[model samples]
Target chain A: MSPTSSLQPLERVRVAVDCMGGDHGPSVTLPACRAFLASHPNAEVLLVGTEESLRPAAGWSRCTLVPASEVIEMDDAVEVALRRKRDSSMRVAIAQLKADDEGHAAADVSVSAGNTGALMAVARYVLKTFAGIDRPAIAALLPNARGGFTKVLDLGANVDCTAEHLLQFAVMGSALVSALDGKDEPSVGLLNIGEEAIKGSETIKRAGELLRAAAAAGQLNFHGNVEGNDIFKGTTDLVVCDGFVGNVALKTSEGLAGMLTQMIKQEFSRTPMSKLAALVALPVLNRFKARVDHRRYSGGALLGLRGLVFKAHGSSDAFAFERALERAYDAARNRLLDRVHDRIRDTPAVLPTAPDEPAAAHAA
Target chain B: MSPTSSLQPLERVRVAVDCMGGDHGPSVTLPACRAFLASHPNAEVLLVGTEESLRPAAGWSRCTLVPASEVIEMDDAVEVALRRKRDSSMRVAIAQLKADDEGHAAADVSVSAGNTGALMAVARYVLKTFAGIDRPAIAALLPNARGGFTKVLDLGANVDCTAEHLLQFAVMGSALVSALDGKDEPSVGLLNIGEEAIKGSETIKRAGELLRAAAAAGQLNFHGNVEGNDIFKGTTDLVVCDGFVGNVALKTSEGLAGMLTQMIKQEFSRTPMSKLAALVALPVLNRFKARVDHRRYSGGALLGLRGLVFKAHGSSDAFAFERALERAYDAARNRLLDRVHDRIRDTPAVLPTAPDEPAAAHAA
Candidate 1:
């Protein structure tokens, strides 16, 4: 908790929303903003889009409209978003987090539902990165067997990573989990092919050595190497890997879950008896469905930036969009930026200056 | 099917079985062999194990006891299995596939449910790769939404791969799918993070160029690039990737499926009302379960070798082991080895002579 949070109890969390982003645009964002404001008593929203697009949320309680002329389409290339779409709603929304002359950012955090490649490019250009951090990574939560989440980093940001970059990811991920989950020390696991240190590729083996060194210095709570199954088994609170492998694992799980759900529906609607059984088992089935529903976990935090930003799924519905807003608000409310700074400062041995050009240059 | 297969109608498939390889040892393999023989009339079995372990099946019809003095434990290292345990059952069973002095092989194919690392090492050491092939790869089947299986290669055989190696994997996978599915030209997809040709790492981009060139020459039915979800979506007949990414994707899917299955069981047994509902929904649930059952797809073929070797899961039961046996029989019956050799000969441009050194050295 912030030191002034208790002293000034009325301090509301301010979130800047990109209303012209995602598949549904204002159709989803307007409704999500209304519901979010209704639920969070101490909250405010800055709706960022064109004048026409923000008309729906005009004059609403605790809502302000910040007008921008352009919008970044879901299929826009990173170069288009960077060099061409200068006044895009996504860019304007992220700019709201920049510190003003008084050292106060216009909004505490920003949330968007847009193209991931474009979003990362815009966010990095505007906010830059924390000192000693070469590139930012995407970190998200995956539900585990313990009914909690396992934080995974570099989801789809940097395809190729060095051992030092992986060490930076671990530090950033540890701080995110510590801030969001309110855990003082979160155990971090390096994703590998086996539990032994000698497993995985050359990069992974070198990463294991760095993580152990960080653990020995009491800067990180590093567990030993873990396999893919260990992510769901909840062997550690956080799992870190190169973006390429992490992206494959994330998408593979999504594919399997989608297939299983479809098969269940197909099986239950096969015959008259099965239809009758479906009615009798509707409650249990819904409960099971809700437990594994991916919509509840819709936000991916862009960590290692100077300001806080959250990216929701581009195809998110109203309910899922609301979840993303809640996540961004919670992150800002918990002082995640300060926690990340503290973690980087504590792990000075592993954190290094840029070895080469930034990986962000390859986002295009 | 082979031309000789039709003319020599009475030709039976001969399979060498390492009965003491899996967790249950003879307890699982003996019954699986019995069941396999009962279902496959035109089949013969050569049981390889210690004399005491093979005694139980001595009087069984169409069964021969091939005695071995040692057993390779599930935890044994690759060096132990290669240099020390030369007389092990796993080694003897694979040896059955070697051609004899009479220009005829002792067994048509070999099946084992032993440690994957040890199996790959011993098999590669004994069988060696084909003339142009540098390393052997583990190819396994995964159930897809099309109501069929997708053949994935290099599951855990070679961790670090080059562009040429991935191209080799594509040719080998194409042949495996062609033989098993009876498709004249099964589509081959290179696993990547995005569908665009310019996406992914430098190695992937180079591999894409090789695959496209082979496709232009009519050597392969290349489906361009595919993302991870395409594997379960059945976008193509085969998905090729480096062993590191492939292994993580496979194991992650397994972990998610296991978690969801457990959650369903827990929900169904939570209360008396839910338990009654479960009883009514039993038939439908069982149908759904049977569709997604992992046991029916247990065999993993070690492709690119001089001899045929199929690896079953170490923890398989009687039913799963039988599936592995049936797969091996089908492959032998379909002349998978000849198809692989034909594909390699056709795509000579992408299949280069050994690049640097063989990747099999890193398997240990």
Candidate 2:
């Protein structure tokens, strides 16, 4: 058994959930919270939302309601959510994860199925970035061929990142997989157009050098540059790229997967002969579906923040939201935030040189 | 029937093949040439390679060998091929597509499965860009849910693209799809992080405005901003983006598809029950494979060049290279190059404003 498994039974993990968020709002989140509480006996939830809508979860012994009058809509602008809705459910939930009385965190972690832009804005404001970290990145788990998952960072957080920002992402991502997956030294692959060292933009090429220096210092297991295919091939445990490239890659894979699934079903049901074949293929197809299910990969942790914050899919159902909560619980129980802090603090600086500066200045 | 079909019966199309390129080199290219010649009775091939490799296809009535001394290795740098290997087979094949006597082109199109960088360098140096076009984009067909293909451009040609470069790609892609797919005004989607105008980088946002203006002027059908998923959903006939984003998206889809296929097979063969199920579901599986076969989508045309150039996958087998050849044949026979030139020339100028200039300067 792991250290986290031992801590899970002895201590209670306080989870602050934004109940008014997501597509179904309270209908989905309340039932998921009920289910989550049942499974995790030592877990408690502070459900933040409108009191009237969150009344369904009021009866749960382990659940408490933190009423907030305002709600951030799905399509609300970041500025509107940040300045206009100060006491919004999403903001209140994130605030619960902030440091409180006796220098202890009010909630171990916070999970929200809300507008990503608004959530990021509020989370950054409530729990500012960790020391030495410039910006927080959105890290998500993607299914790989190894039957395991690869952690990809900066999914859509920082669109235009410098080489130093990429190096920071690598450090944060390394800390993440190490804490959650129990890998002592996780391999980090810098996402590029090709595996060759000479490939990619000036920012990426410089980032590769920093990653190499970090690997040399035993800070990370740098796998050099990897192409997009390497992400699914599980060439490394962690992949790092700018938000623009990473977001495009993630969405493209989702789109292609959906198309292929639709095409497979259409082919199987096209004619009477094929329909008979589909009946026999049902079991195998179900197994395949379970292996690549998007619901299994619902949560994206907003890394580099001083506190643990996870963003569940905005359109998540009860089951999907539950998975996101479980992911957060695991991270909190394992003390992911502390691990990141320690890792970033201990590592020797690998800051990139400015574009106009001499290349010698970048040497650590 | 299309105008190309009418012209096919009266005229014979000459194609130049770089037989020394790709993984299999002469072995794959030779047999694919034989099959191509057999299918297109009104077509001839100029096989460019070493004299030793040319000996195998000497007996074909319509096939003529154009021997070249040097061969560009797959890993060779662009400068090496450009400055050193002047007599390379890939260079010679591209040269055949250039205008020869009486201002008439020597070959309708040229096909090569060599190093992409080297091929692009040689093609640009020999053929040059079309009038008013800055750079050539790599455009390929991707299978979509509509059972047809969507043409995507600038796969990896120009990494850092300006807004004006994106507009050029849009114009070129529109013309290619229009002539080959018979769409009078094919819809072009600007690949972005989100559909909202507020999302994406400054370059992409400006490109969107230019595209909208082009659409209003009746030069192309601009479908505003689309997420990566829209590429496979067939939301538009053509998707345009900078080389970095487009390359990452394309490769990620390929990687995910490959992983899914592997997982499906592994699941089917895992248990005795599943083995029997696999046997019964062979027909449906075959249909699924046929629908999403990567080999069927091998060729990516090097658009905006003065002469027509099509690139085959470096690792293509006989059948895959044949698909590339056939695609080039289709593009050549349909007068794709001429169509692109005409479309770009007739379209009203919607150039992007200079970075330092006011937004009002772009209202053309």
The CA lDDT at B266 in model 1 is 96
Off by over 4 Å in 2: A1-10, A351-364, B1-10, B348-364
Error of 2 at B291 (Å): 1.2
Query: Which one wins on TM-score?
Result: 1
DockQ for candidate 1, C-alpha atoms:
0.76
True contacts kept of each: 0.73, 0.74
Clashes by residue pair, model 2: none
Model 2 residue A119 CA deviation (Å) reads 0.5
Off by over 4 Å in 1: A1-10, A353-364, B1-10, B353-364
**Positional deviation of A308 in candidate 2, in angstroms?**
1.0
| lDDT of every predicted structure (CA atoms) | 0.86, 0.85
**Model 2 — interface RMS deviation?**
0.8
Real A-B contacts recovered, model 1: 0.73
Across A1-364, the per-residue lDDT of candidate 1 in tens digits comes to 2221222112688899999899999999999999999999889999999999888887899998999999999999999999999999999999988876556677878999999999999999998988767899999899999999999988989988999889999988988887778776789999888888988899999999999999988878899888888888788999999999899899888888888898999899999999999999999999999988888897699999888889999999999999999988888777677667667766778685334222121111
